[model samples]
Target: MPIRAVVFDFGGVLFDWNPDHLYRQLIPDAEERRRFLSEVCSPAWNLQQDAGRPIAEANAVLVAEHPQHAALIRAFYERWPETLAGLLPEGVALMERLEAAGMPLYGLTNWSAETFPYAWEHYPLLHRFRHIVVSGREKLIKPDPAIYRLLFQRMAQDLPALQPAELVFIDDSQKNADAASALGWHGIHHLDAQTTAARLHALGVDC
Candidate 1:
């Protein structure tokens, strides 16, 4: 089906998304790694933090709630690092082309509330998307059907003609992309932005 809408996952699909890169470079000690990873990255604990809480609030709440890991929690926040690479030229070009072609564009990302804005400070071009959906802002993360549904609803609002097969979503994570597809939306697992953009352009999707 011809794609009337093109949605993208912001992190790895457009820019490099590597938490390990921060850990491996910043924290060389194995013991510190174990401590930080356990308390900070634990899904249950991180969920509260990811859902729009200020980092300080998250830190205090997490530390108080998980007393056993209090010491590690402090280090985790202090050590957390983020990076921003320039948008890939091909990806940027493709997005512009798609915009010019009048295809509705959207973004679905799993970034934490704090992180997304910080990332935005660096990658201002993110403002280009027609509708942007971030899990942190919605208090729901991807791989969960609700987040994808929200994107679908928003896209429908902008491109009233939108239908399942007419939308194309790209994400680096199979789990997330699969979730989008499970909702009957068309999705492509991204390998690399340049190649993926080229392929989409070839398909005449305008991206």
Candidate 2:
């Protein structure tokens, strides 16, 4: 069956989200900034927050471990909005095109429940989605088949239920895309708006 909807990942795919954007000001040295992010405020550490851990608790645990970097750890969430530069214009244009073409759009994101509100306030485009499944709210992150299944289950509650095979899941992470594809959903490993638009066009998305 043809795809009925397009699912998007928020952070990298739709917006520019990089800790370095915020850390560059705090840590002067380029190499040191990279080291601080990789060793101290690691992706693994942040993933805990994405999985539903309170940002305050996560910050406290890290601060206690590295008292020297206490301020930096707190700044991660305290100045979190700085990390998001803005929504990618190209991505927004593609979404607009898709919307104009009357394609259904949904979102699935591994974001902190605590900070997602900030994004909701800043980015009005999020409200355009038919629905969004947030990992922090659900306590389930992508690359986990259960989370993918949960999205389908939620959609099933609607009239004329959406099928997995009738959706194309797009993400910056190859693993997440592969996971969706494994579940019979079309997967788009999104790199940029241009490529993503082309891929959608090829998929008969008309956007």
Candidate 3:
């Protein structure tokens, strides 16, 4: 079957999402940074938090376990935004090409309700997509079969209409991409948008 839809992960793929930058701006002390990384900076913890766990509850447990970075963690959690700071030019061009080609497009992002709207506002290009699925609003996170299943269900396409192995999905996390591939969706390990777009083009995506 020919490719029908193109999906993208927001963070690291569409734009730069570096937690270290946050720490560099907010917490300048090397000792404090080390302590925080050890106590509170496991990237995988985001997966746990996104998997329907209450953010407040997660914070409480972390603070109880490690009081030193509790204040920083709380502030970081509160300050987090849904949309990125700026759009990547390459990403914009690629999406434009995809849209111009009449290829169906969708976005599957592990995003927060608070910040998702910001991206929608600052990046009007989102209006070009067929659908946008945000984990925070859906109350379902990724790398889970259920979330992926929800995407398939909401799409409401006949199985015969899509090549499960050919439908392209781009995500920065290898674990998430691998999991998506395991469930029969083709996953592209993404870096920057231009490289990703080129790779997808090679995979037969229009742009």
Candidate 4:
């Protein structure tokens, strides 16, 4: 089937977001910072918020478990804005090309609902997507087939004839991409903009 639409994953794909951006400044020592990120405000712990857990609740849970690192735990969400460095230029350019070509674009992201507003406000280009399915809003995260199904459901509202195979999903995580592929969508494990563009071209997508 011809690719009819493109679905983008937000964090590592479109936006350059990393807790390390904030942690490096907070804990200057490389080893200390690594430990803090790994043991304290960890990726797994932060994923709960991405899964729709309330920010306050997440912070409280971490704080309770590591009282000594309470301040650091609170800082995770308190300074969440710092984590979003900016948009990836090449990905933005590719999106722009697709938009210009009139290909329907959509966003499927695993981001905290509370922090998403900041990106929505800061990056006007995010408005380019016809619709965005935020995992936090739905209390689901990617790599879970349910979330991908939700995306198809929403897309179907506007494009009733759309089939899973007609969509192409680009994500930084191979696991997430594999999940989309399981449902028959063309999943691009986006490692870089150049590689992603090449893959899209191979799939007969213009951009």
Q: What TM-score would every model get versus the actual structure?
A: 0.76, 0.96, 0.82, 0.98
Report how far off residue 5 is in candidate 3 (Å).
0.8
- Report the error of model 2 at residue 76, Å: 0.2
Of 3 and 4, the candidate ranking higher by lDDT: 4
| Whole-structure CA lDDT of model 4 | 0.92
Estimate every model's Cα lDDT from 0 to 1. Answer: 0.73, 0.89, 0.72, 0.92
lDDT string for model 3 (76-164, tens) is 56765521356667766777788898877888888766556767886777787777778877788877767777777666553345556
Model 3 steric clash pairs: 82-115
In candidate 3, what residue range of length 10 has the lowest lDDT sum?
76-85
The per-residue C-alpha lDDT of model 3 at residue 48 equals 53
Instruction: Identify the runs in model 3 with alpha carbons over 4 angstroms from their true place.
Output: 30-35, 157-160
Q: Could you tell which candidate, 1 or 2, scores higher by TM-score?
A: 2
lDDT score of residue 9 within candidate 3? 79
lDDT score of residue 69 within candidate 2: 96
Estimate, for each residue in 1-207, the C-alpha lDDT of model 4 and write its tens digit. 888899999888889999899988889999999999998888898899999999999988888999998888898889989998998999899899889988999999999999999999999988989999988999999999999999899899888788999999999999999999999999999999999999999889897
Regions more than 4 Å wrong, model 2: 159-161
- Model 4 alpha-carbon drift over 4 Å, by segment: none
